[model samples]
Target: MLWGALPYMVIVFCITATIWRYVTNPFSWTSKSSEMLEKRLLRWGSLLFHIGIFAVICGHIAGLLVPIEFYHWIGLSDEAYHMGAVFGGLPAGIIAFAGLVILLVRRYTARRVRATSSVGDWLALAMLIIVIVTGILATSANAVNHSGFDYRTTINPWLRGLLVFQPDPALMQTVPMNFKVHILLTFVLYCVFPFTRLVHMLSMPLGYLRRSYVLYRRRDGAIYPNQNQEQQKERAM
Candidate 1:
């Protein structure tokens, strides 16, 4: 299973990266107002998406880094674990889902936005929706599947094994196929990440914010004064 999954993952990443490298160059894709709007959607969508995504990533990293025993040693009972997992996962899932919905709606509902969107854009959003929805379902199902087996116990060992090229199938088997599909979809998404507009994820923090701040300069070479400055000064007085 690892062998089968690993190669495709690598190939996907390579293909995605190559495509993104070419496409993201401003010179490659020509547009004026359309690009501007895409940038706008990206700004808002990315802020929500990246914060949620980073939280999810941090949760995953925490799962890998902190052993179940550590939590247990610290007095985290099963109930506590369940509560923490539910609270952490649910909000992250909702944020990701909302971000995707906003992006998709912008793509289809806005005339210029829809025209500017490509087939790849649609595919990326569809793939992300699948991954996020499946993940939410998997988390819900897990609550139902709590059979006294401490999932926390297995994560660190599994991650250690992954680092050393020895992923334990037993741990993998413990995860349901639906969950497995969600994991696989995530892998596929990563492989394709560099290729899609999803590539914006990597560039988002810098690109998104930079694009949002439209600057203007005065003829005297000073930055243009904010129109709100006088209002703020009056309010302060």
Candidate 2:
């Protein structure tokens, strides 16, 4: 398993580095255009995508950090958890998938957008789709594996340990190959975030709001000097 993941990790790291270089020097490209439609699409699409992504992250964090007892306390029995996983995860996945598809279609289908889009932009969208789709598959498969020594319960702990710098092959053995692929794709997306247009993910929406127009006025106004005013001034002098 370790040997298999090595190639993916290496590719992810390389692509990540390349993306970072471009992001840091985006201004090197002399030509760019801004359209209101594109701006609005980005604004709203980003909002939905960010909110949904945040929820997904929170769900993952909860699974990893929250104790089973805590879940039971909140009226989530193992059965409830399994059912919730299916019902909750499927719709969320579908929504995320839709958002990603819309963003991608906008990039390719819109002439103005396509003109300004870099290779990094398309690649970022593709990577996101890959990650989301794989996650959806993993979630669906997890429902099927609930009766057995499940991948999430057995393999995820090992992967978590690896993330924390402790690798365990025995625990990893429980993870299905497809699950590993999903995990790897996600890691690749993370590695690429700082380098691609995806860095927008890290930007503050408050900045957009700040750019919005605010009204203000000068306390005093000076009118332009016309011929009449000049003659009047001359006569007074």
Collision pairs in model 1: 12-191, 13-191, 16-194, 16-195
Q: Report the C-alpha lDDT of model 2 over 1-237, residue by residue, as the tens digit.
A: 453456456556766765665577755433233455477666556556666677677766766545556777788778767677678767777677777787777777778888878887878889988998998888787677664444446555665665666656676565677777887787677676655666544435587766966544333322333335665576577
Tell me the TM-score of each prediction against the true structure.
0.71, 0.69
Model 1 whole-model lDDT (C-alpha atoms)? 0.69
Query: What lDDT would candidate 2 get against the real structure?
Result: 0.66
Q: Which one is best on TM-score?
A: 1
Predicted candidate 1 versus true structure: per-residue lDDT over 181-222, tens digit per residue: 876787777765655655544333466765767678666444
Candidate 2 to truth, TM: 0.69
TM-score of 1: 0.71
